[model samples]
Target: MAAMSKPYYVTTPIYYVNDKPHIGHAYTSLATDVLARWKRLEGQEVFFLTGTDEHGQKVEKAAQDAGMDPQSFTDRVSQSFRVLAERMGFSNDDFIRTTEPRHKAACQELWRRLADRGEIYLGAYEGWYAVRDEAFYGPDELIERDGVKYAPSGAPVAWVKEPSYFFRLSKWQDWLLRYYEDNRRFIAPESRRNEVISFIKGGLSDLSISRTSFRWGIPVPGDEAHVMYVWLDALTNYITAAGYPDESHPRWKFWPADVHFVGKDIIRFHTIYWPAFLEAAGLAPPKRVFAHGWWTNEGQKISKSLGNVIDPLALIDEYGLDPVRYFLLREVPFGNDGDFSRAALAGRTNGELADALGNLANRTLSLIQRNCEGKLPAPIENPHLMHDTTLHSGISDLREKVGKALEDQQFHSALEHIMFEVRYANSYITQMAPWALKKTDPVLMLQVLRLLHDALRVFGTVLWPFMPTTMDALLDQLGVPKDQRKLADLATPLPGGIPLPPPSPLFRKIELAA
Candidate 1:
């Protein structure tokens, strides 16, 4: 595909500051980071934003429980998220806190727009509110568990009655359905799209847009007594980070985000409520909102209560970053729930990161260093291949194959094809017996080694978005410059005599205690 001339904007849902950073947060952010990196590599201008949602009743209560003011509490916890992003190598371009002056301005501007359009109205809200989710549910949507009510999502809910401001969410139901029908991709994963359609068909009630009981939020534009709904203030962070209320802002080109990467739990907000708010404000909805599935630990649900919320930092410390990142996209289909296991992580590290890509890089680079005078060898003009079509066909068609896979959001498939090439390289080396070729026909050995260099060039370059650090270091070892690391450079071979860095393993095996 030709490079996109238009800018690409992607976002991870602004995480709630009520909780600390976890693997679930890392999963969404990392997936978006990969997409942002891919778009930049594709030669498109990209804006990637992620940050904390610092308001809501849940946050207010959490702060009180922590014995601190809301701002101080959010500040402390939000820094953990920022630190997590930095340590995980997330390439987020902007991190917006809702409490920031810029974000407050954006939220108020949006609220005023909706209010002017008659989409906001004074009302009282009485419903079962899930403190954990910061969401309210209808009577029919609640379930009883041991004499306590819970949202369908299993979050505990308590009755909330307060003076509130309501958004005219019901008015947009038909329009939203039509939009979904017209766009077809407004919500991703056919299953998710179907679910939204069915839910909207069942009905959409007007949404509570302001809470009078909670003062720890962006106050409603004209009414100091009410605060903007956490969802409204939170969703506006997208445009806020895009420099909303200022068309001249350079990042405004990224309005109508290319994609909103969110978890399935929040699909209702993104697919329905967020679009309604944007349309009410006379703005276009984001191109897509893809809600990915959750991760369980070792076939059991991962939860704080269970003492099994996986700490992404600890995981990275135990296993290197690239392998951990690789395992995430590789182990699960992007939109489906996955199981996390130390055993699975260690196995993939040893098997693929260590045995396949890492082992292949060392073997090929070591051959060049020992046999080719520490430089790339000359390639034969047209050499006869002695191997089967399996690998050549795969390696040759890799760019288009992987590109299509990524475009389709088939991350696992893309990584699978990449590892396929790695396996093919290993098989090809064994088939040609490059070491033996060195003694029998040194010239043919050079051809095999050159072939290995070209093949590694393709896979390593393709692997960059998935495993940036490892691929960058691997490409550097192959003598490929950073400027030439785009998708267009995948099939391009290195010049014969570029000096190389000494080879080292890209990933290490994580040994588990026996």
Candidate 2:
């Protein structure tokens, strides 16, 4: 495929600041980070943004319970998220906070733009509001059990009646449906697309965009009586981080993001409400909103009450950041829900990392050092016809397949393809018996070693996006220059006869205590 000339913009849903960072937060951020890293390596201009959503009734009440002002509470917790991002090695270009002055300006500007366009109107809202979800529920969307109404997710709801501002979301139903039909990739995962299309087809109601009962959010521009709803405020952060309201801003060129990665539960807000708001403001909707499934703890929903919320910091401390990042993306299909288990993590690390990749690097580098006097051997021209042809074909095929997988956002499949190459190289080494050939025919041994170097170079380049640290180690052992690491470099071999570094294990086995 030809290289993409346009910039790529991607975002993670701004996390709520009411709680500490958890595995779900880590999962989404890591996925976005991997994409950002891969795109940058593929030579695209990329922008990755992630931040905390600090405005809502939930934050207000949580602050009250904690005996501190809302800002103070949010500041303390929001830092934890920032720390988590750094701990996980997230390559985010911007970290936007709703309370930031720039974000406030963006939100106010969005409100004025929508209101001036007549998409905002005064209205009274009476419905079941779930504090846990920070969302309002229609009667039909709520479930009643034991005389109490709850959200479909089992979060308790409260009856709320207040004069509020509403966005004319209903008016865009047909436009949204037509947009979805025209842009089939707008909502990702075939299953997610059907769900979103069905929801929009059912009909969209005017969305309540302001709350009067709380003052912890961005005040509606020119109207202090109400604050913007948390969802509206949060959704605007994407544009805010890219410098909206000031089109001349340097990052503004990437506005109308290429993709917005979000959790499945909030698909309606991202796929429906967000697009309507953008259309009302005379801006283009994001190119795609891919809502991925949630991760449960040991096959059960992650909950604080259940004492099963996986702390991401704890996981990082237990396993290094890259390993954690690799496991999360490689273990589950991006949009499919899965369970997080320590045993499963250990298994991948032991089997794939230690046995396959790490051992291959150790074996190959050790052979080069032991047999070639610690000097890289130059590759013979065209080695053996059959062996050279097979190696070239396999590497070329794997590169194309991996590139396609990344383009489709199939991260797991991409990693799996690269590992398959690793497996093949290991098998080829054993079958060819390069070590024995060293004593019999030194020239043929050099040819065999050259083939190994060619394959390792390609594998290292392709694996960089997933296991960056390990890939760098492999490249260093092969004496590859940092500047030589690029997607295109996968097709070429590093010059031989350059001294290589002594090999070391890439991954150490993690033993879980009984």
Candidate 3:
């Protein structure tokens, strides 16, 4: 197992602490949560991390606007993000806070190393700075809106000049391009990769790494008057969690992350600037950075004035956790923007979860309960259908396809493979007519039920990461022990005539007010 041989580390972009967590935050978390869970199910070691980005001018202003100090504000808002993660049923290994002492030490150490390596130098900077993005953009990158300048991303910007420490990012433009060229898969989805390459090719500028204008961030080592750029400070959290400066730390094994799950807006930071910073610090960049697109609520874009933003908690309340998780990944291509509508969401919940998978499990198990005397039948007494038929071959091929799809970060493709088998199982049951076979051919009926039960086993094993709780219930119906719920374990046939509990509904059709 790659996970056991070489640990898998994954991180969601540490969320900003300015507002309550939204569907956007949940989207990234859900994606990485599923990936991390899948890695663990592969019987490998995994470190799944998530946390809040506490310090920045945005946070500082938000705190002041609320009449509180930055620390209190971050602490308060950070708890909300943690609550969001917990409420969403996230199984994160660690939740890091930038305000924590260990993180502070990590940030300070990274700053000193970059400074010592000649990658950093004192400089004066003048540019259109977007506090919201914590980014400084050249005038050409800003859009004029009603006499004010906004970053291309729509965040308002201000002309600012200050003495700061700058990272020699311009010096590494060619090297960064070569890294992307040599490592073709460094940035995901092809579109994001092209965007980063174009931006770097257009030109790289030395990035201001220290901010004297903002006092709410980690201070530059040896110069308390200057604070580290929020993005720089935030990016260091990855290494801080990995125990930087102490290469022997057990967590450092996860240093070069398997993936960094981020939103499309931050692709440049992750793809261009982040890798360069790590190489300068004498560390390897994360293996892959997957930048996924945003979500629109219903048909309208989410906005504050429209009040159309999705609260993931409310979405989960209306639709169960697993359904929401499944819909997000299945509804859109992994890297494309998707629309979130209650109708679309509920349709998948009822159509896929209830009618397709849940119904298949219920009918197969109920048939076993009635005909097999509440016990799971042994592996098909007649093994032809179990090992040699088209159904068997089709399912056998799926494991490889789905694994490859996931390896490519194609979440929708992976789930599509599972659903294909699901529909096949439904058609197989219809064709077999197990209900009719029960009286005419009792022996054959028991064997058919056994085959269907085995099919459920396959679904349960592969679908566990996406729908853990529901899969647990379905696996229990097949008498699958808790410890043996992995892909490798599905091949072991169920012991003959083992007791299986009564079938319970795994997914209920959502009832909405008409």
For model 2, what is the alpha-carbon lDDT of residue 202? Answer: 77
Over all chains combined, what TM-score does candidate 2 have? Answer: 0.97
> Which residue runs does candidate 2 get wrong by more than 4 Å?
1-4
Give candidate 1's error at residue 381 in angstroms.
3.4
TM-score of every model versus the real structure = 0.96, 0.97, 0.98
Candidate 1's displacement at residue 224, Å, is: 0.8
Q: Write the residue-wise lDDT of candidate 1 on 385-453 in tens digits.
A: 634445556777887878788776788998898888899899888888888888899887887788788
Candidates in order have lDDT scores of 0.88, 0.86, 0.88
Residue ranges of candidate 3 with Cα displaced over 4 Å: 1-3, 385-388
Better of 1 and 2 by lDDT: 1
lDDT of 3 by residue, 1-514 (tens): 2336888999999999999899999999988988888888777889999999999899999999999999999999999999999888888999999999999998888888888899999989998899889999987787896888889999998889999899999999999999998999899989999998888889999999888876998888899999999889898889888887788998998879999999999999998889999999888998999999999988899998899989999888877888988899999998999999888888999999999999999999888788778998777645754433766666767767777888788999999999999999899888888889977988777777877788788888788878888888889888999878877776678788789999999998987678
Task: Write model 2 residue lDDT over 94-158, tens digit each, in one string.
Answer: 99899999999999999999999999999899988998898988888888899999998799999
What is the Cα-based TM-score of model 1?
0.96
**For model 1, what is the C-alpha lDDT against the true structure?**
0.88
Q: List the pairs of residues colliding in candidate 2.
A: none
Residue 350 displacement (Å), model 2: 0.9
